[model samples]
Target: MLNQIEAFQPLNGASRERYVEDLIFRFEANDTTSTEKKRAILMILCGPYAYVMIRSLLTYRPLNEVTFKEIASKIKEHLNPAT
Candidate 1:
């Protein structure tokens, strides 16, 4: 997963790190509406290189103690209910 994420990258380390931090913080807060969470997740998943760094960090370490796969699966399920 990390390798798959890294393949899309050319991101600067600091910015990438910040994005990871922000993602973790948001996930932890759990204050956003389901719609908002789905939107953000969709934005990340839909983009090409834009979300690569964040995805790499997620695959590398669990955010807010939640597995990236779990969050991603949920988001995907939300987007595609029939799946």
Candidate 2:
């Protein structure tokens, strides 16, 4: 299934919105509704930096207890910080 879908590229030089949109498209294409599955896919495909950032962002919360939306929101807030 990963081979069929376009590979997730590194965040370098890419817009965060584009990166997130691509992830959502893949999730929809696979009919993924489970939060756990979404979080797994996101962490696995989002590269090491993002994985670490997510962990740091949710330091107080157990990773298993974190929601996909929370991870996504943190990524957005980090990548698109206001001036």
Model 1: lDDT to the true structure: 0.46
- Tell me the TM-score of each prediction against the true structure: 0.32, 0.79
How do the residues 1-83 of candidate 1 rate in per-residue lDDT, one tens digit apiece? 21122322235555444444455456556554455554455355435664553456357554445545455554344333683
What are the lDDT scores of the predictions, listed in order? 0.46, 0.75
Per-residue error (Å), model 2, residue 21: 1.6
Q: Per-residue lDDT tens digits of candidate 2, residues 1-83?
A: 53343333445547555777778787888899999998888877776766777899999899889999888887788777888
Candidate 1 off by > 4 Å = 1-9, 32-46, 50-66, 69-83
Query: Distance from true position, residue 43, model 1, in Å?
Result: 6.3
What is the lDDT, from 0 to 100, of the residue 68 in candidate 1? 53
